[model samples]
Target: MQPATTAVIALHYQNEVLHPDGKIRVGLDSDSPVRQNVLDAASAMFQRARACGLPIVHVRIAFRPDYADLLTNMPIMRGVAASNAMTEGSWGAQFHEQLAPDTGSPREFIVKHTRINAFFGSPLEEVLRIVDAKRLLIAGVATHSVVEGTVRHAADAGYEVLVAAPACASASPVTHQAALDSMSLMAQILDANALAQFFDELPS
Candidate 1:
């Protein structure tokens, strides 16, 4: 629970995923309370982590303008291709304004991933290593996708992982809760207040 031993990874907080105007919003419930809760919780967690000096890693999913890195053959990715979602350097690919890192902050790290699992083809692990992170505090859009995928991988990689429940959302509440249930087997699940308490109790 020590701040120094932990890094907060905010995943896919991009305009493409979280904003109402996002390209993928067509496939998501733009008015879902679950989604809003996740956004609010994640924002609060980011603020708390910054105040506590915890390393913050922002993980986003993006691809080349031509989407050469994307698997267009996959059904999910096919939709992405049709919508041109999360194209690198596009407005939709940028992190949501509220959760974006200050460009001048050396402590904030941004990892752009092209895959579902943040670690699959990204510098996430390397950045965590640079911060001496032994545990990861994770939150993001699509609880059933990136959140679940990353939690399983992180657990197998031997990092202590905690999922801030309210900070994760999915297109459906059923899927969201289901993913949370399944991920609990591998990661500790906490709400935002409890996560904040973990930081507050850290030894000074």
Candidate 2:
């Protein structure tokens, strides 16, 4: 693998998803080992990709302030609506500081998405195409949701997908593990350290 052959897609690292004080943190244990692992792993993964000169694309879930684009009838969207999380201009919608794009890197891209799959209505595919990326290294919150959704979609779109398991979290550890197991059929699953090693070995 080379830097040009791979791009890292980080999904939904917004304050509403990763921060302890986030609006959607109700009933979630902020101090859990799983949660901490995700934060640390994802932060380190981002740093490694940046250092290796790989394109890093950050995907965020956000809706208009009026939430006109939000699907309020959906159970998850209802919860999101009630919590008022990830509104376009809200603080909860901003990317986590640790995983934010480096201002100095022209290879960094930030894309806003309204759907679970990052590519549904975003420029993700176009960006990846522009970078000539044949593979994607994925990391993010909610292993059962964004991580799985994006991986499946990417695989279907003809991109080889590698998931950083330790860099993903969900409200339930069981659900997270189950999602990872299922996704293994379509994507290669690696831990944060392994993902770092993979990128480090990529030819310059």
Candidate 3:
């Protein structure tokens, strides 16, 4: 995709989800290497995307300290509230160190969201519009949840979408693979090498 019309969005790469010490570690650390691997893999692509002048938007999920902003409508949502996870101003709600949002970069933006779909309750869609993005590169901590959710929304919204598969992880291999397979029908799924190479080859 052309750099001028493309953007990269890294979602939920937060301490609450991706860090080994995260409150809601999706899976046993040993059984899910993708959790950590995805950070390095996605970071590489983000660096290239930055160097190529493509806008980078970091999306995070957080709620009020009293959990006032969260709607515990489902079991998972209730779990988040019960665990007091991703509370605002807490380290657990912060982005992962490797893919931290750059506040000083003009083309970089941070969109705080509270729903499974990043675009549902956030300015992510408007950020893409502001950046004049026609194509999007997406990477999220959980492949089966946020990644898949956002991909479907982006597709339905008419933006060309690309998912960096290596940057996506889930509670298990089965879920991860299944999500990728399902997302492939709606968005282009790119392996780590291909994603890295795509960013590296982008025109500055």
Which candidate has the top score in lDDT?
A: 3
Candidate 3 at residue 68, lDDT? 84
Query: What TM value does model 2 have?
Result: 0.93
Off by over 4 Å in 3: 1-3, 30-32
lDDT winner between candidates 2 and 3: 3
Q: Rank the candidate models, highest lDDT first.
A: 3, 2, 1
Model 1, runs deviating above 4 Å: 1-3
Instruction: Give the C-alpha miss distance for residue 126 in model 3, angstroms.
Output: 0.9
Where's the lowest-lDDT run of ten residues in candidate 2? 25-34
Residues 50-71, candidate 2, lDDT per residue (tens digit)?
7778899999899988889997
Best by TM-score: 3
lDDT of each candidate versus the true structure = 0.83, 0.84, 0.86
Question: What is the RMSD of candidate 3?
Answer: 2.2
Model 2 residue 120 CA deviation (Å) reads 0.4
Alpha-carbon TM-score of each model against the true structure: 0.92, 0.93, 0.94
For the record, the alpha-carbon RMSD of candidate 1 to the native fold, in angstroms, is: 2.4
Question: What does candidate 1's lDDT look like per residue over 1-204, in tens digits?
Answer: 232688888888889988888988524766756556667788888877877788899988888998888976667788888988889889999988888886677678889887789999899988988888999988887888888999999999999999988888887778888999999999999876787788787643
Error of 2 at 19 (Å): 0.6
